[model samples]
Target chain A: MATQASLDNPPQVPSQTSSTGRGFPTGLAVLTGFTGVMLLAASYMVFVYAPMERTLGNVQRIFYFHVASAWAGALAFLVALVAGIVFLINGKMQWDRVGKSSVEVGLMLLTITLTSGPIWGQYAWGNPWPAWDPKLTSAAVTWLSYAAYLMLRQGIDDPRRRARFAAIYVIIAFTSVIFTYVGVRFVEQTIHPHVVGPSASTGEGDFGVSARIGQTLGFSLLTFTAVYATLLAHRLRLENLSERIKQVKSAVLARQG
Target chain B: MTDRVEAETAQSTRRTLKPTPLAQATLAIAWKDLRSELRRRELVAAMLVFALLSLLIFSFALEVDARSRAANAAGILWVTLVFAGTLGLGRSLGRERDQGSLEGVLLAPIDRSALYFGKLIGNFLFMIIVAVIIIGPLSVLFGISLFTPLLPLILLLGILGYAGVGTLVASLAAYTRGREILMPILLLPIALSILIPAVRATRAVLEGAAYSDITIWLNLLLATNVVYIVLAYLLFDFIVSE
Candidate 1:
């Protein structure tokens, strides 16, 4: 019955080959193009159109990309969490693939956020890295948690067990991300600027953005969301191809024996 | 024939009794672990010695003066507990995995949540015992009375939260290749949410803060404990399920 079901719905392999003939799906291709164009437009607006901050000077421009990356990273992890829960509910391999791809992409983007954050800190606060800064600390912890997720995946041998455990783990690990997102409010003394929420700390340069800055920031956020979708779709395809290769390798070995 | 039928009815009634109550099943598993640990005496002894060694190392490393020691005592206490608790959790679960008893426990008729509560209770007891033993030596060394009535209450809540999450993560880590190192890596980040409030509350209690002043920290600790316990209970069956 299982074999018949699988045969009835054959896997759809994309035909629009990118030089190597392992074709990128048309939807992914369109997404890649859209993301690239939007990213260029966002960068142009951020650098040329947005006004300079009176307090922090030109270096504050990094905030647009930095915050955009952080938002994208958070959204990616949120997708992973949803995928993980769905995988747990139905035991679907596709959901596992989505979860794994999103985590990898999210980790990459979060690493960018963590690095850019310190540079912004150095320009704004005279210190490159401030210990006990709540958002930064929480981000570090979230990064470590998902990094451990990847490491956990590496340690398990059986693919099914690995998928199951990873799905469960990502669901739990996402709490750290939630905590990082809102934990700053509950924490007593954070130096991170409260851009969206009410300012809790008495730190300098925690002001609201002007109209032009908001426009640029909004554009950047939208562009990065597209970028995240593009990356996730490509990563999912890579996972599918790898899985197919593994199946083919085993089949060939059986035939040879 | 009537006597035989009555006897048969009694046998069927006995056989049809519900499986052990949740609380009883939980305690039974906990008791089994406790009795086994009592026989071996390895987990608690190792945890105590490690905690004391951590204390000694902290004193030497910090070059803590009497005044400094009093000020930093809460941080010292929690750091010690976190490491020692991690050690004890890893060893306890590692033994179960190695002995193949985890499988036996899983195969038993009780619900997986019962097994979880059992291990949680066992772990919480071991942590409290280690904390109790260390508090005395720490008090003598630091020259501050660490034995406030509020202290144990805080420790209980903190360790309950810790063990609740730690047991689940330890079980997950036990199945991994780097089983020994993975528990702390997986556990410490989650435990921080609990430990932060715990350390703050412990400090407030030790410093004799007003009841109102310490209430928030205590509430945070209680909230985290409840969250972790519920999360572990919900997710553990999925984790251990084949």
Candidate 2:
């Protein structure tokens, strides 16, 4: 139906003033403001509220935001995977847009988690990048897989075909995300901290979570998730605007001819 | 038409053979590839020569003593296998695209996944042939014992997973521009799950580690193999669809 509609009605360029005057939607703007406030509160909890960790000192504070970013990154990737499956089933460009946007958000979050991880590692273990560590290796694999997902998206010219192939790739690439986050626990040894449920026997940097620390980490996770939501909403808006601009350009070229 | 006559004849032959239609179609596609390959002798030869050359480069670059070669050998072998396998996958699918035969194959009445599994089988066979041939030179050049009983099993599992994913990704990449470069970029990251366990299993087997130790990596390899193959099977239809 959308393809038919676009075929029938050639796009028209909006007035320059109207295009530039478009304001943020009320709901998204509110969410963005709320997320901003929560981020500030979470930062306070990380720096001042949570007690300094005994052994690792202030560097352990990075754990709160670092783990939270990792959680948000995984959630973004999960969103991409679900959106992909939905796009394949229903053949909707909306889900494809959501899927690609989520990957961009996920890649951004993963960059933060990965880069901050080494900072903590440098402080604690005196090694910034541990080459053979299973956790690090798997995390890198996850990052590269999504990066490839974007490359796959770029290579296709047809929107329908791009969406279809990208959806398939998203499904395949999520396995790497699963492996990085969950499967690494099965490996024999990792110097990375596993603070959640049951820390592995040979896991380094294991720490006891006091109530205050747990509360901060919880708040940080909530804030980061909200951040993911806000970022995804903004990304979708940007994509829709770009689509309109492309349609307008094509229409102009056709009229000139 | 001759096409109709051949189709009817093949149909009768398949009915007599009594395999499921999917299996019949799969084997026919694979046999078609193998038969052509037998005549041309191109894909496997290129892969084998590339594998050996990479093997040579590994030995020269590492320049390790015999003791360390045993350790480095698994990494070297898997890397060569991955690179050479990519070569074969690109060519095998690229050939079908360039010759415009893939469209004809799609025009057949078989399920699309039959095409995937067929290509996967053909690629898997080519990789196995290359791997088996390269083992002699690998052991001789690296001066390591690759003759363990478990080595073939490891090679089978590793190549099975590699070719399974490779065939699917190759099809996905073929429609895109610059497929030669794009295939490895799309494949190698996903193949790491297969390669990591594979290299570890090969290393464990080389060191004569206890059976229990190597079983873990073997099982991981098997699990990833099942995952990739099933994913490829379910997803291949959308890839080949118009």
Candidate 3:
């Protein structure tokens, strides 16, 4: 349990060097810059380069970022799932950190996918929210599953036990994410567009993709993937720093006693 | 004290008893739970009452036209079963935690997964009992026929998957604060995967859809059961570790 004294009197983070005695890596900086540039270019391609749909017109442009963010969200969860397995096998705290950070990033990206999805859906489906669509319902379920993952983490105070329990949970929760991405496509009743390969012919929002739209979709995916990586790296660093601060605080408490 | 004598005799029997095989150990734990429940009769009774009460509410909540009743039957039954199942799961595990028996169970010579399977079996049986008892009233109240040959098979698979995951999660929640409330929050979303298909399959069965039409859902329910049971087997040890 965290004591009120330690909570109120927090340790100051060293400005120049981390507890590792290192500054930010050049590789991360370069990746950050590259992601920024790619994001700008991807936006240009989405709004300017990709041709407006024959029917959906300008509203169809949301598809590029929508699918890209969803792709990034799924990728982040995949990373967490792998991190969870490794953490359980090796009992490594760093792997636990990676798993936690990835889920946080994944949840953020999923929120974007879910919220932006409804906006486009309002125009494409004439309903901002369609409860019957398997794609949307499963995505909501996936979101709730990960949200519960965070709540589970919050309820446990022991670090190692928390990490172990979280690893077990995140791995189990990945099923919902898989269902959202792949399993729902098998359902014949969903009206959500299946932009990927051959889907059931029953979807109402299905559209034909042209050459430029495909290019922009690909670039947006790359940019969002980069964004996921950048956010995860920064979140991991923050986690590491907070862990160090806890160590220092506990040491100070022992000295005072 | 008589309590000390009981503990001493229990320890003596354990010393005389050799380590049982995994299946035997699992059955012993499951039987212990069943025997205890049989004597007390509270857990299943509460669950049965809850299940029937919800059925009563649903009969009025949905328009009870003969046509709509069949259409609404599947959803109402699953929802009733899941809520009742959650209540039963929480109580079963909460009893172990409250009595400090889980630690004693953990100290046994059996494998951790034996403990998991034991609890799963007990929970599965409770769910089956409540599910069976509810169907009679549900059919009578809704004025529909539900005695199809295949319905029990679907109920078995669905409850297997539900109880498998529910036991694992209830154990997790048992150690936390306000575990009573936390049980449903953590369990329900993951349960959606299982419940949706169960409801769909049941709807098809009720509507007299061909076996061909229902095979997809039945297959999915079986696959989910296999996955959850395997995952629970692999992961249960981590939860029980000191």
Candidate 4:
């Protein structure tokens, strides 16, 4: 076994079963919390101080947190995809858990993003139910793909084989979102207009900001990023525990044999 | 420590052993599957009959007016092909797996990807034949001119992509516990990118859209097929390894 003192040296993988736990540090924690406080302040600044849009009104205010949640979810998805690649390369069961947990968390945030988007849609676009909206359609598909990922996992029994297959499968599903998101850009001219009422699709390019609103929006985004990191830390730990339990159970069975 | 190095060495040795070339192995396995299915003729007959029935039902439910016929002919035809094609896919792999030929093929020296391609080709051929049968009388009944060149190209590309993806999805479904229900749930969404382009290109061809209008859809369809083929090959080894 590797020495504890030498762990401070190069390339040492801190064991998962170590009593003190494996990831993150005290200073990092304090800093992340501080940054999170700063972000919360930013959210307040945006909603309270940011000037309302002349057309879309206060409903457009959700764009800051809205975009941030969506951003973090997309970012988490990329991380999960990377985790999947790592799982495939290493064939380690832990990476599979990381992939699964990250996806679950990502799905939660994406659900918020999807829900919040339509609510924002109803207030700002004058119609909450636009079937042809690319974002809505694409997000629905992305959500479904992850749901499909869950089903794929449920279908397999062997941990290693399941990890390997899910790794490959998720990577394939993830890329189509990129295609779908951008597919409209190519055909933007022909897209179905906001048929139910007035058009709010014109907002993609409409970014002008009051100073207070800007700072608040910026802070809200920061807050969520910190929140995303914190949630991920909690999830990874839970996964590590379940994994340890599995290994310990198997080990006991083997020793009994 | 000693066990790890020994296992690694053994795995390395396995890697260096000669494996069959992809094309020759693919053609050989496909030929084998086609020959077996040809001898039985059961899958083809069932799929053809199923395709006809689906068309008939659609005609009745749709209340097939001439205007509706003009607009819906392509969509109905493709939808019929899609539904009928699933039976061919499910039954083809389902039978192979059930009969124990699956293991015999796995035991062969050839790479497992060869099996994927071979099955895909067999499925593609069956779909094309079914399309021909479904089109002839359905076209007469519906007053559709399904005889154009662009239409054939659209059909061929759509079938190739669908069959290619379907072959792998079917294999995975065969191994998964719920072979019947799990297929469409898994296949349709994964197959969506391909399906969208397939529908668009087929519709464009039928609607007499400008070639330029249809070109991008065709290219995207082609890319979808290529990506699925490569991904399916990468996945075939894992899905079939056990």
Candidate 5:
């Protein structure tokens, strides 16, 4: 059993050095550059190409990036959920790293979604914060849930135990994400419009998306996915470096003693 | 030698065929908690007094007249329950940690799910007792009779859901450095999903709405209760494991 445990978690020194020496792989750099260009193009399409809506006019352009960010946030959370489950099942530190990094990025993107949502709401619905909006409320709730997950992580000291608790928590928190996406529709009345699915309702401030607008939305979502991937890779590398530093510091202290 | 081997095989087979010890362990743990509570009366007293005081504060803050109180009764009831229930939950687990009894419990030869369900039952019972105590004062103070049979049923479903998630979260929080402060922060957002439907159902029942009108919320409450209980049961082992 001891031999198996050691073999499973072989000394981390060589791999860390080799990866760090490579210093930012070409793939990631290319992906980041591609994402930057696509994001710029998407913005141009939103401003110059898509026709102005008769209802909300040019302010409706925010919907393209706003909805794209929401989608990306949900997708990131889903990645965290999957990674969490895998970590719990396999007890792998790499999976935990993936889960934590994804959650951080997801939380940042969701903040953008939540903030942009109100700006759009103010111009479109004439209320900066519509109390009865189901989508808005659900987004707020999901954001709080993940924020709690991060806070819980901060309070635990043992890396293994922290990862374990976070794994269980993110899995549980994913249910709230699902609820935010679908639960509002179950309530009797909601002012938030459903842009997709069979139960899409034309609520206040909803406008028809022309073909050009749809293209822009799709392009923006794809660009955000690329950005999410690049960010997650960089965050994972940072965590590995930090872990390596801790190991080296402990080894040096032992030698000095 | 053959006779002895045959006898050993028979005993091992009989042991394998017997029912698991899970049910008995769950009951024993729950009974132990209740008996301890009966002797000390600590958790229940705090929860009850805190709940009553919350009602007092809400009344003053809202300046709730009889009509307005009636309208806000459901929201008031759930808010009071959540705050009081959180207090009870934190104290209940915090005691085990403070006394170092949690380690002993884990060391016992029992399944972890049994420990989880045991805590769930104990927490559920405490919340229900507090809810029952608050009903009388709520009735007299708000000038509305809140003693309907349906009200208790709704409270039971709601408290079950709350306690299901609460017991698991409390155990997790109890291990943290900021156990007391972290419990509510971790609990409230997740519990909100359960509380929303519960508050809706309670309001419908309070207003004497038709059964059909409130059925959906009741169903939601039941679903949330079962989902949380099962999920917590399956996941408790992970949280408690080293």
Candidate 6:
């Protein structure tokens, strides 16, 4: 029944010759261009438009986007988690595809977080992965768990079962992620203090950001949210199109009978 | 499982012939399953052999001297059972599946939960037998009194929780394509939360720790089992239907 349904509605990949936004001059091109522009503006604001931290100096500025990207990745995973539940409920393949898109974005964003975080860590504070600081390890484990989720799906031939298993894994992975994140603070006293501010730990770490800088950070989050949506839509279309091609080829093969 | 099926057929025949006079079906089903497993012993023998081999491997691999081996013995025992138990579980489910017997059971008039519970009980008892065999040799090897009251209690709870989760996972993995590899891969992480606390509780009990000292660990084990049983109950239908 599922095979027949898949055959009936072939995926629709746009027949465009080049990578473009619905036949426009650019797809990734526009994204890169906007990112370049935002980067330039952000750099200007970061050094000149926003004030620096009194205690940590220039390094604190990295928090504006580092934390933003991490936060965004976490948000994406949450969406993926919820979407996984929805996909399981109705057997909607589209929901599963969207869930995968969010996961990919989350992975990419987490990679950025991991990369940028250490650099920021090196400059501001010394040492990395001091303890089983559940925060850092959880993120890495969440990433690994999802990678394994993909591997699990890859091993299965049946699409419906694959989606179901994948959904179950996401739920399990999401639970672990929460456990890792939420359980960390109580278990260990680490150098990585709460971000919301001045305390016995990284003193005045939160005090550096002014109102204008906070506003700038908010705008950066908004921009990335837009970028996430744009990329998600593009990825989903690509998935839909590939599915169509598969259907078409299978149909053609059947007709060749 | 075979006995249960036989009993079910007998009861159904009586139903067709005599109706309400022969309506005691549930106990007959349970009795059949228990008697068949008691006779065949295939699952128990495999689990026991696999568990002993794990202990042997661990003893050789660790190179821990006599002094430390006793302390590490509890960990070694649990780890061996958890892993080698996978083999027993996969074989147990895969055999039923291969023989087309699973369908017969599914076709029988019984609650799905009854079938699940029957499998769980059978698997749990098999694990306990393996643990008993393991305890004898492990005691000789580690020079620890594993037959002590507390140790048996710990073993029973640990084996119960482990096999409970293991049976459900095995049933699901039976239907998956790459049954052998996928079973362990899927089972290990999801079962990690449960196994950790069980092993921990056992370690605490073995170290002459008071029950109060290990209460949290045991509670964690109990809580995890309850959660997984509920989840497995809800989700087993999906795997069976598939």
RMSD of 3: 4.1
Candidate closest to the true structure, highest TM-score: 3
Question: Of the candidates numbered 4 and 5, which has the greater lDDT value?
Answer: 5
Residue pairs that clash (backbone atoms under 3 angstroms), model 4: A46-A216, A50-A213
Q: DockQ winner between 2 and 5, please give it.
A: 2
Count clashes in each candidate, considering only residues at least 3 apart in sequence or on different chains: 0, 0, 0, 2, 0, 1
User: lDDT of model 3 at residue B238?
Assistant: 88
TM-score per candidate, chains pooled: 0.90, 0.90, 0.92, 0.82, 0.91, 0.73
Indicate whether candidate 1 or candidate 2 has the larger DockQ: 2
Q: What is the C-alpha lDDT of each candidate?
A: 0.81, 0.86, 0.84, 0.73, 0.80, 0.67
lDDT for each residue of candidate 4 in B47-117, tens digit (9 for 90 to 100): 89988888888778887676556557877887788888888888767887888667666665566787788
Across residues B54-150, which tens digit of lDDT does each residue of candidate 5 receive?
Answer: 9988777776675666568888899999999999899767887798777656655567787788888899999999999998887876777888878
**lDDT tens digits, residues A1-257, model 2?**
65456656765665432234267678878999999999999999999999999999999999999999999998999999999999999998879999999999999999999999999999888898887788788888889999999999899999999999999999988875565446545854777777666776665677888999999999999999999999999998888778777767677667655
Task: Tell me how candidate 2 scores on lDDT.
Answer: 0.86
The DockQ for candidate 5, computed on C-alphas, is: 0.52
Question: Taking the tens digit of each residue's C-alpha lDDT, what string does model 1 give over A4-73?
Answer: 5544654444322233435657877888998999999998998999998888888889899889999999
Report the CA-based lDDT of candidate 5 relative to the real structure: 0.80
lDDT of 4 at A201: 57
What pairs collide in candidate 2?
none
User: Which candidate's DockQ is highest?
Assistant: 2
TM-score of 4: 0.82
Candidate 4: segments with Cα more than 4 A from true spot: A1-43, A188-217, B1-20, B60-71, B137-143
lDDT of 3 by residue, B1-242 (tens): 11211223445455566655788778888888898899999999999999999999988878878676666899898999999999999976789889877767766656778888988999999999999999999999998989999899999999999999899999888877778988898899988888877888999999998888688888877878888889999998988897
Identify the runs in model 5 with alpha carbons over 4 angstroms from their true place.
Answer: A1-18, A199-202, A254-257, B1-20, B65-71
Residue B93 displacement in candidate 6 (angstroms): 2.8
DockQ of each: 0.49, 0.64, 0.63, 0.41, 0.52, 0.23
Q: Model 4, A8-118: lDDT tens per residue?
A: 342333356444555666755786688678666766665676777776778877777777788778877888899988887777777888888888888888888888877
Real interface contacts reproduced by model 3, as a fraction: 0.53
Interface RMS deviation of candidate 5 = 1.4
